[model samples]
Target: MPSTTAISVRNVSKKFRLFASPKERLMEALHPFRKQYHREFWALRDVSFEVGRGETVGILGRNGSGKSTLLQIICSVMRATQGEAHVNGRISALLELGAGFNPEFTGRDNVILNGAIMGFSRKEMLRKLSEIEAFADIGEFFDQPVKTYSSGMFVRVAFAAAIHVDPDILVVDEALAVGDARFQRKCLLQIEKIRTSGAAVIFVSHSLETITSLCSRAIILENGIILADGEPKIVAEQYLAILFSESKGEPNLDITNERVVGSSANQGIQINQLRDEQFCDVDPSAWAGSLSERFGYNRHEVRTTNGCAMILDYLVAGNGCDDISGVWSGNAIAILVKVHFSADVNQPIIGFELKTDKGVTIAGSNTFLAKTQLQPAARGDTKIYRIEFNTPLNEGDYFVDLGVAEYDGSPGGYVLDVRRSMMHLMIRRKQEKPFFNGIVDIGFRFTEVDC
Candidate 1:
């Protein structure tokens, strides 16, 4: 069934005014100048989308891409010069640190104040006060003014209060990015709880991993317009494609910067359709062009990859099946390999490997693991093989590597790593259960007792 729309935005546009200089503003204040010495900046333009109830949507873009402006508009912190935004329920907005906070007031006072701003009743805030205190972990710092709190403390206290207030919609900006790692994880847990209650979430972040993991759909904005809005994987891929296209992306090959991903290994291969003979392990450096030029390995950040080979194919099912992509966690899918024999090759080692988008292999099985004929044929002959398993991936991106080699390992194998795209799948929780969200669904047994 289609989810119900909880939030709707139609042709929303926001613009800001900037003064040419202090002198211009002073003159304008002293006496209205006939010609205004200011320029108008449009942060957002004609953006429209509907978010379903319980949907977690991510807004991703480069800095100054209007992501923050969009969030602020949704939260109603800033007014749009034109267009419309309808927020249907109570909101928990974790906007910039202390946007609604009193700088000179104690954290405790601000918690109460911010909670009220979120539409929490005085009695309700009192009841959830302990929960906020526990989650925030600010200790005595809660007694001090918010201005005295560190960036970490500011976010923790603010986030804890925002979520614990029982909001029907949540808006998170990049504020959480300032907190330490441990605190970030804690904040995610809280957000997860809120999402399970059928709340709408609008998360804005530059962190692709977080967006891909937590959201079902993602929006990529550039300048003041929406670049793309669809599946998380495709949107992220589109972003990657544009971020590091051949002509204009990541430095070609010789990335002396240690930040480059897969910098050390020459993992050169473009992920096209998959075949058995396609797997060839060759030095990426030895490939046709620069690694950076050939593939998009720009900006080596964690959760980003540098050099890696991968494969893509139609994941099949049924007795004789062929299907791939759009599979979710807990779904069973088959790995179908088309083995092509050339060079009078005899028995070709056919195998498959699955890796995190970061290039870490979590699962791999080959003809060696199964200890079978793998496959054998004369020149120009091709055959098919199959492997099936349960996919227990956490919500994120994954790549599959395919290969074929000789047992002697004389570099006699052709390993083609046309890495599969990072996969994005949603895992829905069961009804009437204590809800949770994360990788792997751990099936648990519970018995109810009636007295």
Candidate 2:
């Protein structure tokens, strides 16, 4: 292993035996022929990977896809049946709820016990005790036995202990999912700090949003095999494709690579610069065939349709233009979508959402949420929807996702057609020294008052 490499696995594989009954096992064990009576299940098959120091790698897979198995092997909780895994530094793992803790020990005592297991002196643990307690924020429970703690409290203390150990490699296996939203965010931020501190982090989660936003690299595992590994966004898309196929019980593993469906002839023309009135004046026939020919189109857009309806075109407009080259923070912007239906439909809904380049959705809304009533549409009918909302976003590049669905008496409804990240644009600060410090500008006011 190289000096910069924190973890390396070569041809790692694990196997388990399943026996139906103890009589069959005893017969097989006592037989002179030593006949096999158990079926073999391979949890991992020749899986190999390398994690350079400071790299955050996310592992995504369906349940029982060897994600936890890989982490367990790396953490030395389980031995691999074949192959070898090398680690260059101490490891801190939160592989499961209350994994390394003694259920009889109090939360405070458990931290001290974990410290000793990691070769830390009791004095050192005591020095870090306050920080862990503050981060966990489970008041009173810190003095109570861990067995009495709720699942959320369990994770808080577990995560707090894991992160404070100063391990060279951190392995987290869906433990953060047990925490509430606020605590989950806190853990993610702490993970970022650890990654930046030159620790290799192995994260496993089913949430694509968390994976993309946090990991610099991602890996997809299917049936104990490494299927896709590379850019977080691309790997996430592949994972989604596999999940969709599995949901339908399809045998074929057909993955579609979607490309930007526009042209380069109009490259010099910035679409967002067009005036709103001009957009209103243009005939649908003028742009229907050339939507991909326009500028500002996202090359990674993924489109899926149910053959009932289709979105022909869309535009983003704000700040005195029908389309926006750039939107200013705290300004009003309108998303216009033109959709056509090929079959009779009742209560069609149109919606759009804004997402960061990393795929974190900032805001989204639909006509149903807005309580807009729409008439039923016959075959070969078309309609345009104008969705306007204020932009309270900080300066950053964002993607726009649009969808048209028919009401199916469900929260998500039935997706007739949906476009993922179809539009790309930047949000700029309207003035220097903007008040917001994060992705969103929720609007805060302050005033000096006499004491």
Candidate 3:
């Protein structure tokens, strides 16, 4: 019978001893009866989670948050100082670049070596060697020593080897970030295949978008403890809130129950009001031009700073209409932003970005980039900014992120308030156009030359 759980981590904790000096280490080894010369540092404190068959769980945290340490423990590369972790199936982990390969050994030899470590016989390794080589796509480097390989080449081989072995649990620790965009997409597809095969995956990445798109669930780790676990969207928001708080030297906000608010701004706009009210009238051309457009609102905002400035609300609507659910490709749309200033600011800048559902930014513009200058603003002032442009996106779901910052005679100066995933926009196929090839559909003239 097959195991129901792919991974089980129970109250796992890892502790490392910190020695003051080299002499302290020797002193402690020489005299066991004396007081210990080292202090204990806990990297993980009772971190507990489980992954079942066919489930993918994303691990997210800032640096020094024990994400890597936890992955190492799960892969059995390091043992926990307390508690226990059990793996029900064979594991293939890509924890670090060139972690398992011997520098002196050729890629071919390393492949066989890794397979042996995974309990495959020599014949079985040879049978799968061709498939691994083709997947890696490293031409002559397969026969050369791994030490001679670049970082990208090294990861290509390591990733190919790990996935080809058909492990029950896959643990990828930010390894895909090193690969090029094309390779990353290929790897994501392969991960999807593995998931389809009923294998559990534990993915650790700093890209919240990746976590949100790929994993059914996500957990946020902070200072070696599990801070939040549930939907990827909620967890990512909590993580961002904590990051913003830390950057501003404020107390960490509980994002679950409370909204992040500025210190001075009380009796501000309510969430429902922001959603229901029309900040501005839509352009006439936007609604009059397209009859196939639909529009709805799904917005989320996080105040990164105190009450210096606030983005009250924003809207993406078709021409001449305040309400929109979706828009056709190549149609005209307008973005309106309402901002309130509580403190005097010099050279305020506002911007917007349109990103694909996969979190890849396709196009965006800001005031600084456009060389637009605005007058300085004082407290209790409100301003409305509008940007109208034709949509260049293909048929797909996209997100709108808005930000407000103050220019300090520098590029991308101090950010005041930023909102991510503020609204979801869907782009549909236009009747006159063919299928677009990439994230954007740039209508260009075409010509062909006969050879």
Best by the lDDT measure: 2
RMSD of 3: 10.8
Clashes of each: 21, 4, 11
Q: Which is the winner by lDDT between candidate 2 and candidate 3? A: 2
The TM-score of predicted model 3 comes to 0.64
TM-score ranking, high to low: 3, 2, 1
RMSD of candidate 2 to the true fold? 9.5
Off by over 4 Å in 2: 246-255, 258-451
lDDT per residue as tens, model 1, 170-226: 999999999999999988877787788899899988777788778889998877788
Greater-TM-score candidate between 1 and 3: 3
Please state the error at residue 212 of candidate 1 in Å: 1.4
Runs of candidate 1 with Cα error greater than 4 angstroms are: 1-3, 28-33, 246-451
Candidate 3 Cα outliers beyond 4 Å, as residue runs: 31-33, 247-451
